[model samples]
Target chain A: MYKGARVETIVSISWETLLDGVKKGNVRSLARIITLVENREPGWKDAMKSLYPLGGKAKIVGITGSPGAGKSTLTNAVARDFVARGYTVGIIAVDPSSPFSGGALLGDRLRMRDVVTLPEIFIRSMATRGALGGLCQGARDIARILDAFGKDVVIIETVGVGQDEVEVVKAADLVMVVCVPGQGDGIQALKAGIMEIADLYVVNKADREGADEVVADIGGMLDISDNGGRPQPPVIKTSALANQGITELVDALVQGFESGRNADSWQAQRVKEEILTLVETEILDYLRENWERTGDLDKAVEGILEKQTDPYSVVDSLLPLIREASRSKETT
Target chain B: MNNKKIRVLIAKPGLDGHERGARIIAYGLRDAGFEVIYTGLRQSPEQIVSAALQEDVDVIGLSILSGAHLSLTKKVVDQLKSNDAEDILLVVGGVVPEQDVASLKEMGVAGVFTAGTSVSQVAQFISEQVNA
Candidate 1:
């Protein structure tokens, strides 16, 4: 009978039902709630509003790099180190969602096989889900939930520092940029989008050929760009494949976060971005809810698709309609 | 033998980003008459759930080589139940130890496919679960 209930009724269950599972540290329920929120289902806003006050307790760290830069291995090793030190860790791996079907082939979690079994650790793999950089919001929200759930550290490892990924890592307290030897375009790519944001740069696959040269190149780039605003970000060499330099990387992460250098400004920025994101999400939700009822936006969409109306014109017309609707409702 | 597409979501939880196995599985699943939604590496529990929900998937296959499977999987299960999405089948394949299989199953994971398990076995299991 419970399984046969309507979705709206099922979702309408008391928050206690959901919170009970979350409080019990039920991972399945947590994952399910995250999915609901990530998918932006009806009534998720109310659920999150309920869960909001319980957040702001976890320290979030972001890791980004070029593809094959050993970002995953570094994340795994770092998480293992944290767990060994008796700290609970939550990890969000940001993957690219399939645009065609809006599903994902997420496999990054396979890298941290050893530490994932620990009771104190939680890991989730996320995809873009048809929204560019939406995974960032998803990661941030889940991290908040994990923080509220009592996690000590939350690591958000993105799928390379593309424009969207850079925005995601900007939500972190500290960001680590990972690079590897022999990746010709990596340094260039990092400089283009990721180099500016890394609090720590890790040279993974350190045993590979030309590791020294790659390190030197990064050093030269940093030297020229060292603005002396804060301490020049540290460049640490690591070999995640061999498990070398993992402790040092962890130590660097602790020092970076605890020393309070990257914490303050980032937190302020994160809060600001979070507020904007919430507003945006709310507006989108409102639009979606009223889309069918109004038929105005649908007509606009159709016009845009058919090139009958420009986007600005559509917006110009829709804004007045929305304003009038709100005004009329208020008067009534 | 209707060739209806089997929609599958391959997700990674936590920071473990070794995606070769997931990519291989996606390709293999796609080749085997399934529409594999290969989310390219690193995902959160919420993102995976959203994917499963919006995609209206038949199976949610998680590939977690990370040792944090218990908590991660638990988080996912919790999300599903709360969203009233308990009907969607959950399966996991990765570097899981034999000892944890029972616990994962107890946590509502329908199938625990580990290393050395055949892709065909996973595909077949999914077929059985969804078609049952």
Candidate 2:
């Protein structure tokens, strides 16, 4: 915060203080370190690498659905339920940011009023930050930080998503797809991508007229979809606002907490996806860092702008740098 | 890209239902390319402090129209201090009496934007304080 100090140097020095604070159960420090990682400050990966071993204990949950599906309310109910049963909870509630402004009015806390003051629950409001998908990798990293902080469960309420945003699958150990009545007919349940990602389905707002029908429709879809070797996904009915049937939902989540350890059918695929994502990020970072410093990127841009060379040729020439770097990596 | 964008928590810390001012500031801050966390109506100061800590926001902007600015601001300031987060710059925006502004600043609020202050001015002041 000093006027002349470099942010990164401050971060590097404070990272220890942050880590020590987290270890000592300082909530403010835990929160600050989360910001450090979420913003991906320099040395962030090192911080994660240091804390990674302390993770793998807490269960991560992801809740996603169309806008107004009561994701936040249900998250509040579930987190409170978990805490009542003697488990600490962390929640990451995602809301969409304005793509134009790169800013967001994160209003999830408005719906999560009950848990805001709970000592057992740590709620964080996050914006999608132009991730295309409604979820961000940073959300998962924050989940890990919470796990390392010893929370028994971490729930990620994805920005009310559409039918195709499946990024939550990459992050949560258990994915709960929430559905409300009167949104659409059963056909809405059959959409290809999001339908396939549900570990459990909640017919939220069950007090409404069409609740059981929605549950039945999802149940019918589950019956038709080939199970292969996977267990049939369960559909539970709950009214998050009425507080009815919440215990059943919590029961399902707690059962998930146990079965998740056995590597549910999606675990292997999720790991592969995560590693691929990390590889893509790392490779892009390497090229951008190297090219910007070496001026090759600028040279390519200049050639393209001057119409002396095309992007195809530019990429063809630049691809070799990656090969050389990989070869060097292998040799070392 | 590694540079930290100032994250501001715009919270309403009393029972006042007038949320238009907070919404305006939230939109303004967002348009300024800052990550703004908008916790809606009637936030208790404890809740405000908790949200600030867990979100690790760079600054906290409380919007008050309940004529309880002094007491509300003091509670927020005291809670933040007790939580060891006094370093997070605090600001107040709303119908503050001109006479109460000095004491609000004395309570560690970095800036106070009374009615009619431009959003850009508030944003400019925040960036100067946080990104300096």
Candidate 3:
């Protein structure tokens, strides 16, 4: 059932039902549960706690690239290839929301028209919702929902990006940074931040004029930056427009994913990060809900706007509540 | 928190190649603070329903300009009904003739916007219909 944006009544969907639906691979239930999680509805953490144990099965892949780097098309091609190989796939395609309006035109599906109807494939469009990193925790949660739903693979396609958007690395088991021909000296891929995040590089639009040059540049740059004998990230060429080189890319993905993200220490590190992030989110959400309920949040914002205090002061003012909450938690 | 953003799917059904109107609505809805998922041109009713199901959108806005609003809208309405999605608000925009508007409403379309409807009016209508 469609709930209005401002619906005051309680969201009728219980987490239990959503969990059951997801377990059954019900597409509508999957979508609805994703909405519930993405909205961070109350009791969502408990819901996720139950759903979390059902996941850890799907191989999550993050696809990121510049605006025109064929991220969507490549995602489509790649996801279709996975389906053809008898894998159920889920896609979370993220786009930027308007900073001014908090709304977004999620058009990545436009490029993904071909796979929209495949029963084995499910695509959900997500807006970054002003998350500065071009991806959001909501997206991460949605990925987990897809995972619990028994999708063999889940693709997280971020909005067209530039240098320094490395959040995908934290979310995906393997991150494929896509670059296309004519986007300058391919050294941009090897630039300090983005280069470090890539498990592989895709030189999309290889049919374009500067394809070979871009490939050569990336290969040369990778040669220069070979540090500590770490395996050099592979640079695969794909023309997603003509559906060429996809098999090779998918083959590479199969090989890369086979290594598994379960190296004991690394897995421990991931769990640590996950717990810390969850703690941070829970604390903030608690504080926000409490303050908003008490109207202190509005007062603080008004204070800031009126020059009565600054954000630092507001943070300081909020610290006492956190301390109180911590004390209560320890007592409990 | 009850903080939530309304999600709308703006789709074009049939062979209508005129995208300017749909594009405007997509952008306009965004500026009005709604997450708009645009499934581009020539979407079948089945595809639209599928997209809505996958998106779990609160509203599905169809911009049909091909003079086949009645039949196309009927197919979409039927698809949604059969899929048990009657709660998803369905609105149509385009060159929908005034006379066909009553039949569309009878078929369960929530609202119809002809040539003169402003984006704010559409946005307001959605907010009203969706939240109520």
Task: List the candidates ranked by TM-score, beginning with the highest.
Answer: 3, 2, 1
Superpose all Cα atoms of candidate 1 onto the true structure and report the RMSD in Å to 1 decimal.
8.8
Candidate 1 lDDT, A278-319, residue by residue in tens: 656555555656776878778888999998989999777667
**Cα lDDT of model 3 by residue, A1-332, tens digit:** 33342253236656777788788878888888788777767777788889989998988888877778889999999999999899999999988888899999999889998799999999999887764332546677888889998999999998756442466556788889898877667556446477766778899999989988988987887787754555787889999989999999999888878874445355687667666776676667678778978898899999999999999999998889898766766775
Candidate 3 regions with alpha-carbon error over 4 angstroms: A1-10, A131-134, A162-164, A189-192, A226-228, A260-264, A290-318, A328-332
List the global CA lDDT of all models: 0.74, 0.83, 0.84
DockQ of candidate model 3: 0.63
Tens-digit lDDT track of model 2 for A1-332: 22223244344557888888777888877888887777678778888888899888988888988778899999989998999999999999887767797877788888888899999889888777764232456787889899999899999988765532477645888888889899878336447477777788998899999988998888888888876657887888889988988999899888877875337556687778777776566566677888999999999999999999999999999998888776755775
Q: Pairs clashing in candidate 2?
A: none
TM-scores of all candidate predictions against the true structure:
0.72, 0.92, 0.92
lDDT of 3 by residue, B47-129 (tens): 99999999999899999999999999999988998988888888999998779999998998888999989999999999888
Tens-place lDDT per residue, model 2, B1-132, is 353567899999989999999999999999998889889898999999999989888889999999999999999988987886777889999999899999998888889999999999999998888766
